[model samples]
Every structure is written in structure tokens, then in C-alpha cells.
Target: MKFTVAICTYNGQDRIPEVLDGLQQQTNPEGIEWEVVVVDNNSSDRTAEVVSQYSKNWRGDSQLRYVFEATQGAGYARQRAIQEAKSDLIGFLDDDNLPKENWLVEAYRFGQEHPQAGVYGGIIHPKLDVPLPPYFNKIKSLLAINNPGSQPFRYQRNDKPRKVPAGAGCVVRQQAWKERVPKQLQLQGRDEKNKKTLLIGNEETEAFFYIQNSDWEIWHNPAMEIWHHLPSKRLEKEYLLKLSRGFGLANHKLRMVRLYPWQRPLMILLTPLYLLSDGYKLASYYLRYRHEFDSDLTKACELQARIGRFMSPFVRA
Candidate 1:
């Protein structure tokens, strides 16, 4: 089967080298042909330079091509990838990740085994510089929260050909793309109801649901793994707060599909406790590492708390 690996990049020159090297190391399949197509989202950095170097120097049958997406967001880049892809089976790897040597081979194998499966996703593990704190670890295990200590993960489906949706290190079957992603994703945004805005974090998740609801399966194989590098600049408390606020925005947008109203009350009751507990733990780390706390961190926390309140009302709809 022929496959095209679609990569969406923005100012990702520093990280592209590792991703390129990892693809080069793939044990080439005999009859299977694969190539990497990078969609550059108006990068002002040396991304084009790095990709050009790889095209010239890399010794592989897999072709490399770069397309410019003048649009600003990731959704725009990904949309272009769908249109530009050469094969029906598409592999997606972020610029900041290194897929396992067998990533493509395994994905293709799974596709062959399950002809009806449209979306195939794999495991994403954080490449952390240091171990997480004890308290943070405990809270993570207890609360089932996902963040620095844990990478986003979906369980293998209970039913065969299940709906597993996560974008980080995954493959998309062409039929699945035509049926689910492009149309709804264009309208959905982060919320299921707000079909006007571009979908953010939950694009992949919603696609999985659509696939399963339409009678196709989603698969998650643990063996298909990718090492996701955490941005060094994002290792601070301020950064986590920013990340949390961004997550809150996505969550608030998603809450608009609420079937019940008590969701807001639940958030109101729970937000303070979560903030105090997680906040104190984060503060301890900030004090120890940066030796100073700033207003951005405070603002991020406030945004998250307020977002929770804002989301509560939507739950009733």
C-alpha cells in the first residue's frame, strides 16, 4: 500500500531533524511506498532550510515535498494535507515527535488486517527531563487528570474496530477522512454546537465518535509509539498555567453540547478545590525552581476558574 506522511509545521526547524532522522531509519517495506509531505504554515524560521537539506541528503525511496499553507491555524495546514496526500492511507506525525521505527509498518499492517477501520491512533509518551514530584504524581493518579506528568491516552476499544481518536501520533484512513474530519471539523471548533469556529483540541476525539457512530472501528495499539518532546520553555509554572487556560477554553467550548444543566453547579463546587490543591503543588515547584511567581500564572489560574463557571451554564443545554 502506498502511504503519505503528512506533517504540519510552524517554526519547527529545531525539531524537524530528529523527525526526519527517525523516518529515514524506518525499515523499508518491500512493495510499500511512503513519503513525507510537510505543510509549512507560514513559518518565518529555518523550517524550509532544514527540509531542503533533508531532501538533498537523505538516502531513501520515500519522497519529500513541502507545501505552503498561507492560513494561520493547524486546522488549515491539516486540511491542505488531506487535499495534497497521494495515498489513501495517511500517517500524521507532528514536527516535535519521533515515531518508532515500526510506526508506519505497524499502521499499514493494522489497516490491512482491518479493512473497515478508518482511523488508527497510537501511543504518545512524554520525553521528560526529570521525574514528576511525589504530590503531583499522587494527584494525577487519583484525579485521572492529564498534563505534564501524563500524556494524552485513549483506552483500546471494548468493541472490535473501536473509535480511538487522538492526533499526536496517529494514522488516518482516507475513507475516514472523507466521511468524518473535513466537513464537521471545518464547522465544529472546540465545541460540538458552535459549528462556525475552527475546531481546536477535540477535533480528533470528535472524529473518532463520528466513525464509531457510523459503524467503523478505531484502533489503538500500544506498540505504535512516539516520543513527544516537551518544549523546554514550557517547563515553568507560568507555562502550565497558560496550558491549563488553553485547555479550559477548549473544555468550555466543548461543554456547549451539554445535555444537562447541573454540570455548571458541579464545576462551581469543584473548581476551587482543584485550584487550591493543584495550585499549591504547582506553587511549591515554582518557588523551588524559578524562585519567583508572576502575574501571568495568577491570570492563567483565574481564567481557568472563570472558564469553569462559564462552562457550567452550557451543560444544561
Candidate 2:
């Protein structure tokens, strides 16, 4: 097969239909074989039943398959998708992500052209239900929405701080993933089922780090695009702060994953320096926005992320 679209979702019974409908509208390339697989990540809701209903009358050229992943994390669900996929190239979409008509063709074409790219992602535009805050753009990336530019580019690891594609609207080569990524990642991603679970993330970045360590390149493909639906709940101050903190908490682990064994000791020693830097940023941000801090959700979220980063070392994975 040419491509497999893997939708990983948990408790997404209400959200999966829109994504499926978007996929059904894809402008497929002639003779290009592709299929869609919905991996249910241990949902307590009727996610399976919803997919099952679709499978009954699925009229698309591609087959719609359902797989259950008992594991609770996004990483595990994606890993399961890779194992079950018949295609060498896999495009991932969260249940809330809706692709444009040309998204699949663009994603497949990019992979064909760039054989060296182990993993790549495209522009994610937010489809917010509520009015965006004035400063929402400041922390919008925390919501997994990004647009590097109109041009496609390779992400160089040598850049001061490394950057990798978010799992949403991302495509990965099966070979690279099977060879480089470990079955179990240090960060297992968020468990929506567990209310008290730490909002730890970076599972996708961790896998990308392994793939990047090899000869494969990571890229940003602007041609491929998707709309990430953001409900009002996600815009709430509490949710955004938690999301930021989760990303921050996973920062240290990702740093360690990207480093060589010899480099880890030095990274550990530099923990104090990192903490001081994060502390400075936090203090400076608070000082600048103290008057509006309570009302400024974006600023408050930034502060929470900084705090998470400062405490990352002490927090066990």
C-alpha cells in the first residue's frame, strides 16, 4: 500500500465522525493505494461503536479498519498503528484534526520526494469555537498548532534548541520507526482516562529524536495542512496551563533522550543553570504582567510551563 492514515483517539466518540468525514473527502491520487485505521486507545465511551457504524457503510476506495490498543498513551496507540499498517508511510491524525481535501496527496507526495525524511509534519490551523484571546498566539503552539512558513524546510538538529514535528498531521516512515524508536518511551503521553495523571507529553518528540539520530531527516511540509478543532474547554485558563506544564515537565526527559550517554552527565550538572534560566524567565514574565496576570491566560500559562521546567529534574518520569 502507498499510505495508511492512522487516527489515534481516546474517549473521542463525539469527535471521530468529523475526522472520518474529512478523510472521506480526500482528493486521492489516481492509482495511489491508501487506507484508514482508527486505533481506539482504551476509551470507556462508544468510540469503537462509532467506528463500527462507519465501517458498515464505508464507501471510500480505502478500507476502514478498527484496532484496539489497551495501552492508555498516545505513544502506544501510534506504535500499534505502525505495527498494523500495511503501508510503508503512515500519516497520523488526532480525532480532532480535520485534513484538507489535498492533505493526503500532499503528505504522500512529500514522502515520495524526500526519501531521507524519516518524519515530517505540516501546517495546523486552529478552528476555535470561542473568540481567541489577544495574546493567544503567544502560547498557541502549546495547543499543537504551528505554521513554520509557506515553504517546506528541513529541521536541523544543530539549531540552538532542537525542534520536531507534533504528532498531529505528522507522517512517519514505517522503516525508520521500526528501526529507531523503542517500544516503550519514557514519556507515555497524556492519559485522558486518569484525571490525576500528570500532564506529561513529548512522547512524539521522543520517537522523533530516535529517528533523527539516524540518517533520516525531519522536515516541515507546508503543502500538507489540517484544521485542529479547539473547543471552548481547551481555551479555558486551567486547561491551557496544565497543557503547558505537561509539555514543560517532559522537557528534561526529551533533552536527555537527544543526548549521547557521555553528554548526560554534563546535562545533569547543568540542571542548576537550566533552573536559573527558567527562574529568570518566570520572574521577568511575572514582573512584566503582574497587573494583568490574573486575567491574562496566556501569560499565566507561560509561567506554569516555566515552573514545570524548573521542577522537571525533581519530578520522576
**Which candidate number has the best TM-score?**
2
Q: How close is every model to the real structure, measured as TM-score? A: 0.70, 0.94
For candidate 2, the per-residue lDDT at 225 reads 95
Task: Indicate which candidate wins on lDDT.
Answer: 2
* Candidate 2 per-residue C-alpha lDDT over 6-119 given as tens digits, one digit per residue, 9 for 90 to 100: 999999999999999998888876657899999999999999999999888885678899999997787788889999999999999999999999999999999999999999
lDDT of 1 by residue, 28-81 (tens): 665568878999887889999999989997656788998887766666677788
Instruction: Give lDDT for model 2.
Output: 0.87
Model 1 has an lDDT value of 0.62
**Please, what is the whole-model Cα lDDT of each candidate in the order they appear?**
0.62, 0.87
